[model samples]
Target: MLLPVRHSSCVLSIQFRAHSRFATTRTITTLASSAFAEIISRSSSKHQIYQSISSDPFVNLSIEQYLLQKTPEDSNVLFLYVNRPCVVVGRNQNPWLETNLKALQKHDTDIPRSGSSVRNVLYVRRHSGGGSVFHDEGNLNYSVICPRDVFTRDRHAEMVARALQKIGAVNAMVNERHDIVLAQQPKEFAKQKDATGIEDPFEESTPQALKVSGSAFKLTRNRALHHGTCLLDSPNINNLGAFLRSPARPYIHAKGVSSVRSPVGNVSAGLVSSAEPFSMQRTILSIMDEFSRLYGSGHEVRDCASRLNMTKSEFNAGDDWVAGAVGEVQLHEIPEIQNTFEMMKSTDFKFLQTPEFTFSTFTTEEDPRLRPPLPSFLPPLTRISIRAKKGIILEASISTSNDEAIAQKQALHSSEILADRTLHEIDAQAWRQIIDSIVGIDYDGQQQQQQPMEEVVDHLTEFLCEKFGV
Candidate 1:
């Protein structure tokens, strides 16, 4: 839609120029200049300016080139946030090993963010394998592109967190309006500084705090990732989105979470002493439960309402789903909502590298100058998209070898979420094949499945090795 408008404007301007060619040179120059100025001011509104300067196309552009060419004089700590608004895994993850490959792929983009964001896109991958989730603009995308020093672990991302806190505080204030104010009268902005300024003692005292800065410890009572862009000193001109759809952090949007929740709220302060991925805890339990029942024992994909007492229609799961190996064993059928489930295998893919690029600008009088008639590319900036989907795993494997041992191992390890057994319980072959598949070894493999159940890891990896020879 946007591309067409840009083209049409270009055509109209060209036609306007062609007609001007027949006029007197003085009149033609005057008209031409007017048109040029109008075009230069294409982004006439602040909102439009935000859209053009801070959305997808900018982020897609090479970060290095964008950074290098940024205006050196404008030194307010520039930040850019990029959110993948789809299903994103951790830095080290195995899609198959950690999630229901078939089910997750089909999980619909029921909720969407602004612009060209798509469903089921994997944005992050971690060493620990798990699941991907859905993310959108409502999730709060923030970035801080200041000097490299600003991003000092807790020091860097802290800015983004505090901003979210400020926003959340405002939201909370609105939620508790009657309490904040005894009557319905307005109160003045507080004398205290926001999260950042309060911590800075050296700065001179100020009665007013920037509205952008949020207050402290305003935890989101509801579930949802406080998301947005974060950039340091660099003028990070890019998309501010991060899909809040990791299994560790699932999208509660569908479950009706529309407010910001502090990251600290979801985590126990005691646990933060030796922080670990929170999703793995429950997810691992789910996996273990499934495996314990997977041996065709007492497993069945019973409706969720029958087990967890969840609202049947909550996940649209007519009933919340749970199963073991017995009556109704499930290998994860795609949900009916999003047809993409077929394409949405329990696949895990993410980009591991903090992709870097280079950009430069000089103060010379000639070309590539600080001021420009228009923001044109210099030497040109390029964008690179890196894809990743690998993870270290435990007690896993996959294979076409349906020997009794393999079947038994598969049954044993892949039981329902509570069947509970150690990885050592299964043999090396089953561990390698089934567990490996769960860990995402054969992710992009276009497996040759018949009409029904598809094969798992062992063969998929073999196929990939032969296809790419890596």
Candidate 2:
């Protein structure tokens, strides 16, 4: 369950840029112009790295896409960011089937002040092909964009695994699925045994590997983008299931990919030593170092560092790299980034992009699984079925257990009201009003039955709201 919490709604305006073993501070406008120019310029550095200061999911993702498209074709780029709490589904996945929209709504609220905007949780559809993922401040997102020829599914995943190992997580390894997982040592292997009889704890026979990172990819004719989420020290790990599990899943038969559930564990949980507290910053730095080792030129390294203030030694002890500037507010000034950001936040992109699916109150030919029983508050034989494409209702029908002709007519009217409407466009209040009008209609002047119908309508409205997240 997600609880309502207040968050800031301001956008960050400051920026910083770093060079080899030195730091230079610049204004937002200057940094955005230079950084934007450098990012898209083909003559720019071959190995580029960036760390996003903003926690906004929309802003961070928009920046990522911009880098994927605008960066030099042959350049190998690494972008690292942490987003505020959000559920991000794949490009073709259905949010209503992958996420608990009703629970997400509990965290939605408006905050008027401004400096850096914040929201408790958001629902996003990313431009990648994979299952849904949950992100928050505690999770670090790493993206590597390179030429298509050099791209391999396990390349960056292995890099991240090495970084995790460097930070004392020896159990971290890339699995055959190209995901980073922590191998669980069996109870028998936990104790010292005869050298001859000891079995490899991480052998293929072990069945309980806990996933710590999940990978997703997007490829173009020239560029390949690989990105993944690393669960470091998330406090909401236990609550992830509540957000990702959808009540509407059993009711919806969707066309796109569905998420594969895995037993997930935090990387911080399996650290070898507790002398130092786990930190996302440390994990990010380790990953950055690993990326640099793989792609950086021997002479020096450059990075678009966040706004955090740090000494030269804090960033790089040797004369290898320096931090620079780029802020979310400045990135928005770029036309391409602004357009992508707005599009990502729009309802059209969020819901209208969903693949075709059907929602039924009872099992149908297309969706043959037995459905959970409906609430007992309504008629036992009541049925509702809906078919949608690109989120628009193409067909709908509603019926009650009643055999009365008047009741049948009301059901038809209700169905007609729903047709052609987009699922996201209809709110709970709108559904209530539509249901009220049809149920309020005089049924052969039987005014005495209207009261009971009203009660039924109220229950039906609540049920629909929960099911559809209207």
Candidate 3:
């Protein structure tokens, strides 16, 4: 109803006011974002907890290495996981020297030679330096990564022991060597736990003390990784013996690190004093809670419940697979991390990392699988000298005499398999004839190939038996 100019002026005024309000709102938002950025910059050293859901030992271990490598020097990370059955050896330790390869081969078959459905055991070598340790679903492994200056092995181990006690392992104590042991628990502890709805897994009558955990450490340029295994309620501990056997040969003189063997026990058998109750899920949560309380900042500690991610989507983008709650924990698996694991397990890669050493092959009599032991009257045979580099046998030679002969010397010198037939003479005539006959013996024109070194040895053993009339 007013003049055109007057109405236009009023409309312009309203528009200016609206724009001013919008500007003010944007300013406030900018200020809040700046403050949040400042807080993040100040606490860049915040501690983090990663709970992996993958049960594949290879995948879990690869993810651990990735996290340790990716974490900032100032930040601290705690990784927790349960791996399927596997044997993890130390970085510097020799696989053949530390474990029984033959026994391990038997464990690798999906179905045992006896046709049992027991799971195959996987072998892994960690970047840390320590003795070999067996891992299964019952074993809980924790790795703590932090700056070198902030790292305290004893304090970290004590932290684990205290958390263990909180979850009903009342008598859990860390030994000097950093192993957690259950000294002894009173029999009445079980009744108190049961009355209070707490779980005591081990039999009350079996009060024998056991080893609960073993730890190892690796210090890099600016950071340190402290990883250890905590035994939970593993059903099959008996299979541990099948893979962790004594050395194949006596007197292994190498500069490599050796494992100090000890009597190990499981945490399930440990003593629990609290009526608060116990469970694997509770134990895992408690350990993380204690870690956050001890190391995390005030807000960080309080927000742990929300920050803890148990889904694949939470950990990695584009990962939709969900590893549902096993027991009480909802686990997550990221397939992208598997590339690293596959690389780590590759034959050429792992084998090339082995240190150089002189090795002696096991004789027929020393073989555990053989029945009706070979007669001692047979010549001092089956003793072979091998010089290997990175686990690959570079030089091999047969030793007829009981005394140790160098591989180079034996290969150069003529050796006698029998009383009169020298190796040099046999190679010129008998060996050539055997090779020709073997080449001619093709299976349906599949083409006969050169026999493998191990099989060649077997053929030689049989040839000797025939020549000596054994």
* lDDT of every predicted structure (CA atoms): 0.23, 0.71, 0.53
Across 324-391, the per-residue lDDT of candidate 3 in tens digits comes to: 11111111233334566777777544445666554444433333232232335433343444455665
Model 1, residue 347: displacement in angstroms? 11
Give per-residue CA lDDT, model 2, range 1-470, as digits (tens).
Answer: 11121221111222345666665643211122233544344444466666666778888889889888887788877788788889999999988889888767456533222122235568898999898998977789999999899999999999999999888778889988889977766652242111111112333323666677889999999999999999887656655766788878889998989887776767887676446777777787788778877876332333234333322111211122223333465454678888888999898999999989998988887789999899888767668788898899988777663556766777688678888999988888898887677756533464455247678779878888888865
User: Largest lDDT belongs to which candidate?
Assistant: 2
> Which regions of candidate 2 are displaced past 4 Å?
1-33, 105-119, 187-206, 273-275, 302-325, 404-411, 438-451
Q: For model 1, what is the C-alpha lDDT against the true structure?
A: 0.23
Q: Between 1 and 2, whose TM-score is larger?
A: 2
Worst 10 residues of 2 by lDDT: 191-200
For candidate 3, what is the lDDT? 0.53
Candidate 1 residue 9 Cα shift, in angstroms, is 16
TM-score of 1: 0.27
For all predicted structures, in order, the TM-scores are 0.27, 0.81, 0.63
**Which predicted model would earn the best TM-score?**
2
Cα error, residue 279 of model 3, in Å, equals 1.8
